[model samples]
Target chain A: MVLYCEICSLPVEFCEFGKSFKKCKLWLQSNNNEIYNKLYNSDIKSSLSKEEEEKISNSLAKMQLKEERKLERDLINLQNSKILIKRIPRTKHKYIVAIANLDLLDPNLFDMKKTCKKFASKFATGCSISKNSEKKDEIVIQGDVADEVESYLREFIDSNGINIKIEHVTERFTNKKK
Target chain B: MFKKFSKDDVHTRTNVKSSVAKTLKSKLVSQYPKLEDVIDEIIPKKVPISLYKCEDKIQLYVVNNEILFYQQFDDLIPELRLVHKYPDAFPSVQVDRGAIKFVLSGANIMCPGLTSPGAKLPEEDWPVNKIVVVYAEGKENAMAVGKLAMSINDIKTINKDTGIELYEYLNDGMWNFRD
Candidate 1:
């Protein structure tokens, strides 16, 4: 069985070649100590000479630094981004919840369709992913479950180690005579 | 070739018919006779296969959300994950330890890298345009897959210039892509 690094998602042996080698090593050491010892403790010297080894390590360090910077930037962007859950009044009392910017949390962890399905089942309402007026994909629920959705999203974000704010907005449509 | 691939590039995705899946399995077996022994294990008969038509006329065969292989034109090139499962099923060459960094970064394999002391090329000459799995000098697993730009014999003799056109490599867009 190929052991993949939980941190980098690369095979354990290839973790050195991945971007998050430091994190991968820590993760492997904690999760699979046997394989970690086999990979890192084995004092098998590389075939490359001193100069080539230094050059490769230097380049790898530089690349890792760049990757770290990029990740920091992404986190900063995430910190600024907010998930908006709008409760729009459709009829006299009926309301629908439209969730926007949920993708900002994390594209990899959050699948819109799956999230919609979860909401549909949990709230016992019809949920779908639809384009908003701004052409951004948003999860539209057919019932007024804004508070429940907000709490669920907050828990989801907190569990994922992300700190993002979820804002609520209520939209009221009034009839007017011209 | 798959450096910039993403989910947005996918145009259409449809379930491959059982008949076509059988033909595909046969085609795969014919291309690499070694796969005959474990083709059933790789792609189970009961599982439904999805064919994703992507940008640049590329087609990807996905089984159970894992991309098994992709087709550019006529050839069905197995992904690195599939190659890792059955390393010996494909024709492969090794590059020197020095070339591993470059290969992982999506650089084409140079003749010198293959002909170097630590590297190993097959004694039997494979013709140009043949797909070959690329392994690092000391690594236990493959790092990339590519097509031969020059025949193996020519690469041995010339020992200069690009020898293989890299298709998919470790950490590239395709390797990191998740459906």
Candidate 2:
């Protein structure tokens, strides 16, 4: 069973990155004060004196310069990382669709939920965007339209001017009859 | 090497027996005798150790709710800034301004990077085989944590021109690890 926050219903792991974390923090304050204290004072101390700030900034500047030199040293090792779209047969006529490498797309222009909703509307009625507990986003459509969806995404991304190469990966589900 | 870690994988990989946790903790204490005083504080009382693989040759340990330490070459090295935020939790060495980029990019640190006016020498006994946190000349938080290649005396007397080994650093698979 997927664990979700009782207050906001977001996945427990992602609660900290979502709005539900604020509610969780409020609950922690009243019910688990010890935990609240631990989380509150967990990170590095934020307060720094002027001299410390100056020293850190100077180090940062020097570090940046050194980083440039390192980058120049390794130009041949660069390799292309591709975005993968996978289709797997879930049932007789249904499919589970997953799109990996969403980081290649600009977040401002690419909305996973909206794009999935639009794509599913063309072929099936129960198309929706679902997120795993780990927060990996996937678009699920009820009916099997894997071929159509793959072509549609290609045209859609091409028209949008994104420079990412997409790889189509297919995994067929095998049923074991006992 | 960086990838998302599912909660299911976490449970599978790290669901260690209590006996295993006890043994691991004992091995850790044996490795770093200085941790005897804070052994209880570092190891969780009842919880099983959660392990996350941070690339090849590196692994992270999560006890209770915090990522307390990482392991390399059979040595358990505690998380520098993330763990033991107390002033004297771990020994530290400061690197020059130019070394920040290389450290973040997962490169082994060189002696030239530490030969700066702002560099803080590691204590005489603190350098050899010890897990020391690395900080930039100006930064308060440690940018990386790594095992030292040379003792303070070796560094003082035999100035090596090349190949100073460091265990781990910022932006390495360990730092970017998520579960």
Choose the strongest candidate by lDDT: 1
Worst 10 residues of 2 chain B by lDDT: B1-10
Kindly give the stretch of ten consecutive residues in candidate 1 chain B with the minimal lDDT sum.
B135-144
What residue runs in model 1 are displaced by over 4 Å at the alpha carbon?
Answer: A84-100, A108-162, A167-178
Q: Write the per-residue lDDT of candidate 2 for residues A66-107, one digit (tens) a residue.
A: 655665564332226566677877775667667666655765
Question: Is model 2 an incorrect, acceptable, medium or high docking prediction?
Answer: incorrect
What's the distance in Å from true for residue A92, model 2? 18
| Candidate 2: stretches off by over 4 Å | A1-178, B1-12, B53-57, B123-128, B162-164
Predicted complexes: DockQ each: 0.43, 0.06
RMSD versus native structure for model 1 = 4.1
Candidate 1, lDDT over the whole model = 0.90
Interface RMSD over true interface Cα atoms for each candidate = 1.6, 12.0
Best by DockQ: 1
- TM accuracy, model 2: 0.50
lDDT of 1 at A119: 90
- Considering only N, C-alpha and C atoms within 3 Å, which residue pairs clash in candidate 2? A55-B138, A56-B138
Q: How does chain B score by TM in each prediction? A: 0.98, 0.74
